[model samples]
Target: MAQKSIRYNYFLNIFRIGFGILAGLFTMPYINRVIGVEGLGKVEYVNSIIAYFVLFSALGIPMYGIRETANRRDNLKEKSKLVIELLSILFVTSLVSYLIIFFVIINIHSLLDLKPLIVIMSSTIFFSNIGIEWFYQGIEDQRYITIRFIIVRIISLILLFLLVKEPKDYLNYGIIVVLSSVGGNIFNILYLKKHLSFKGFTIKDLNFKRHLKPILTIFVASISVSIYVQLDVLMLGSLKGSTSVGYYVMANKLIRFTIIFIVTLGSVLLPRLSYLISNDKEQYVVYVKKSLNYFLIIAFPFTVIFLTLAEDFTLLLGGQEFLPSIITMKILSPIIIIVSIAYFIGYLILYPQGKENIYTIAVIISAIISVIANFFLIPILGHIGAAIIAVSSELVGVLIMILLYYKELSKLELISVNILYYIIASFIMFLTIFFISYFNIDPLVNIVISSILGFLSFFLFLFIMKEEIFLSIVLDLKSRLNQN
Candidate 1:
């Protein structure tokens, strides 16, 4: 069962990466040509604000749902009962969220001029909160989730090409997002239907009081995570202009793609880790060490490449108008690497131990630091300042979390070998890129060549270090190919 989950996760990661690349390639030109940097920034700012509301609407149900389902996996009837109860909770929460957004929009309508767009986009929150995919995630049904995402992306790309015409078409873009999100939810619902009948499901069996404490804790934790994650763009728009917001957002989006890859790995490991931690502490430690080692190995080299190629990547994806964000991208790349590790450790190691309050406190501290940084930085440095603030705040948060994690789980060892390998590989990759770029090569070509060399050098370093995680991955792939 564990092996199946791992394989499923591997496939989903590949699917997600491919989908991201295609979506980026197709949508970048459309967005850049139509809305331009400033327009894109405005959209991003609004979306970021909406994202917080979305997080509120979610109330961390997905996390709670997965944990519940995993714990009750042996009893199908109990699992179904839990699912029905969770779905009921989400339904009420989502409706309340929708109403809150409506009232907020109505009250701030004159100030923000976000009436129709916010109204249309609010449906996404409700649809996404239906908790359909939570079941699949709990059972490790990655194939279904991956297929649904791929189809949604493909259809959304078609809509973008067919409908989006000019800068003013931002309204249409928002509508398309709402529509695509609904379509994805519908697919998830149908997929869920195939696994269980909702005919006899009821809320009567739910242990609401028993779960209330944990649910509220998860909610607070989710809000804290959302604040640090989404508040920067919101604050950036308010402090600086939307165009400045847009440049920083574009850079942040690209960095987020990197973080998504790492998060995918974390998502795959979390349920298993949660289950293992309850049953076998020693085994859980082994899994945590293995997962963290893998994360460092993959994330360090990518961070180096992102820092090296930030300028070229920004220019290629967002065009010359967004050239100012080059520095922002470079500054934030390493932060994403750190954030990826922090997220993995928090979800898989800390939260499962019922230490969500510690995680929440860490995120709150980071949020406060982020708010301060943005207040000071935006006036002077603009979007670049936003990026700097983001990176610094995340670093501070992760450092605190690491200390807390050690305090909570004193048995877990920080593997010095993993840290040493990552640092050495990152240094080598950074130097390789520096030399390549210093030779007066064309920026685009230099980025490509440097990226190739950086990747190769990183992998070679890992190989020389005899990293068991990398070796295990290699052997697994070879064995799968041989079987095929």
Candidate 2:
């Protein structure tokens, strides 16, 4: 049953990623046409502000709920009660936070032109706090959540095509996002209702105090994560301007989109890692090592590709008007590699051991460095400086978490020959792309040919290095195709 669940989660993730990529592809041109650069920057800034408040509103309830419900999965009554309790807490907190944010927006109406749009989009925060979908995640029922998102995203795409006709119709774009959020959550809530009975759920019997410590720890960690991740856009918008914010956000979106494969893999591995850590230490260590190895194999080549083709990708994705973000994208590309490694170290290793404080502290330190870097850098280097600070802080944070994880594990097998082979293979792939680009080929053709060669070299290197994960996946696919 667990194996089947894992397999289902894997396929669901593939579908989700495919859908996300398609959505991005569809939305990018429309957004670029409708909002233009400055307008897109304004929209991103407003959304970022609301996202920070949403993080506060969430207060780590989803993480707490997922952990507790997964731990108590066999106990239906207890799991349901825990879900109810967490939902109630999230509800109250979201309401209060929304009120405060709305009040502030109303009071500061003159300074911000998009207060109405922010207010409309803020409903996503309240709706998402209901926590029905997370219950599915805890029990490994990802198909439902996956289907819900897919349907909503399809609807969002249609709405974008229909409503987003002009550049100044930013308010309509805001509406599209809100509608998608509400529609998706509604579907998730309805879908989840079939699996668990919420009939007897009540807030009166819940005890928040029992889970206060871990909840607070996760809350602080969430805020810290948000600081380095989301706060940069807000800071860029404030310090530089919306035009710069648009460029930075566009670059970030492209880099982050490329890492979705890693992110999906990590999501699948996290629950498995949590289970292994609870049940089998030796297996947990093996799982962590394998996961990290797979990440390195996938992430390293993509990092090199992004660094090489940053300018072409930016021009293709966001147009020539977004040339300013090319440097930003280059600076931020390596972050995917580093952050993927850190996520494995932190979540799979340190987090399950109750060493979440270390993760929180690392993020806090990174956030501090980011703020200082941005303060000095954004004024001089503009968006590119902000991007540099963003990636630098991420690299530093990952280093800190890795050291902490190693200390907790009491050994370091991270520098093994396997990792060395992965690094060498990545370097070879980089050189392959570099040689392909050295010829005075057309830029677009160079990118296509280089990407093909890079991946071909990566697979050849993996074969030579005998990477088990790569080999296994290849053999499995080959066998399945033969059967078909």
Candidate 3:
């Protein structure tokens, strides 16, 4: 297999995420108006509930498998044995997860009403196991992953618009959402033979016990993270009814959509970092430093723009029915920076270094704080409280991660002086966009004009300042273009 440059992988990932944003821009407003808040809320409510089962079925394999597979990427025989063992484990966990989903739906009175939707969405659990996306990610196969995703996403979007014509069609919307999210996974098995094989691997060669401790450790951390992440939706549905969940979902989705760009580098580098940890420690450190710098440069600007233009974005994406989500979006805007720093530290640093136990501890503490805060806050403040807790909880997790690993993190010089440059540029960009907001214009047109001027002004200022990172990127793109 051929290896791609980090720049190439990053481009593919960005393209993939960019297409998703385009799809959402087209679909969200349509879905929001067609389904209305309560109807959309009902689908989200069930989706949130089903996400727990999906999380458990994963059993942390998504993270653990990628690291473990990258470690053996050069040795196909060993990789095959490892993947087989992990799949066997995954099969059992997924079966158990689905069974539990079935049991809960029948046993719980409230869920009975959602039984049909729950069952429809539950197909994701089975598809996830077959996806084996970890193997391709381990080998850094960005081309296949990106292509498959775009194809499935396009199909899913077409289906969503066609089938989900009204509020009552929310069930159709639920199934379409599930397919859009995980449908690409179904193609993974078809592509497996080129990279993975079970030929020389015997059942007895598998050592499931060897993986249990680490997998369980990561699994616990995942559960903790989900508490603060997914539990807000679940709790909102339980306390304030599905309508509140709907509002929070809109804001949360919008915020998370932007976060995909911030975290794209981390996802691309996870396998690379895992590989470098054992083979090239010096380059690994360099990549970590560069990764953090890149994260901050993008995160700062994105946070400022989103904060200033939250209303335009909410109106543009979700329309007037979701106007309430604008405040939530503003409150959650800073999460782009928070999550960027945390992702670099946790996924790029600790997990690759086999320090997930430490990562687990950080998130567990954050989860405890989040749960206590949500219980007291959600009833009084509703979606706003959830938004506040979401930011604070993530901030707490990142703080603990930094504090616990301060001695190690300090030596890397993750905080670059270029941060000052990025901050100044973002400030200039914010002024540009903020000024544009006062002019009378259509929301979509305002966003277009604001984004164009804002980014041009941003880069114009950075160029004037002669920022090293920006210059390096410009030179790198020029070099690539010249070579081509």
Clashing pairs in 2: 34-167
TM-score order, best first, reads 3, 2, 1
lDDT per prediction?
Answer: 0.76, 0.77, 0.89
The positional error of residue 436 in candidate 3, measured at the CA in angstroms, is 1.4
Arrange candidates by lDDT, descending: 3, 2, 1
Model 2 alpha-carbon miss at residue 128, Å: 1.9
Pick the TM-score winner.
Answer: 3
Q: Per-residue lDDT of 1-484 in model 1, one digit per residue for the tens?
A: 3336565686776677767665775577668768787667766766786787777777767788777777776666777777777777778878887778777876874435767667777767767776366677777777777777778778888888788888888877887777655558876765675566555545575665666677788888778777767877887788777888888877888788778777877787777777787898888888888778777877888788888888877777777888888898888888767887788767887777778788878888888888777788878998788788888877887888888767655567755676887899899989888888778776668777888898888878878988777778789889999999
Evaluate model 1: give its lDDT.
0.76
| RMSD value for candidate 2 | 2.2
Per-residue accuracy of model 3 over 27-77 as CA lDDT, tens digit each: 888998899999989898888888888889888899999999889988989
Better of 2 and 3 by TM-score: 3
Expressed as tens digits, the lDDT of each residue in 1-484 for candidate 2 is 2434555687788888777876886688668756888888877888888888788878876666666666777776677777767777787888898888878787885436887778777877867776455576677777667877788888888888888888788888887877765557866665665656656656676787877788888889888877888878988888888888988988898788767768766767666666666788888787777778777877888898889887777766788888888888889989988888767766666666677888888888898888888888888988888888878888888888867666555563656677777778888988898787768676568778888999899889888778777888789889989999
Instruction: Supply every candidate's count of residue pairs whose N, Cα or C atoms clash at under 3 angstroms.
Output: 1, 1, 0
In candidate 2, how many clashes are counted?
1
Location of the lowest summed lDDT over 10 successive residues in candidate 1: 1-10
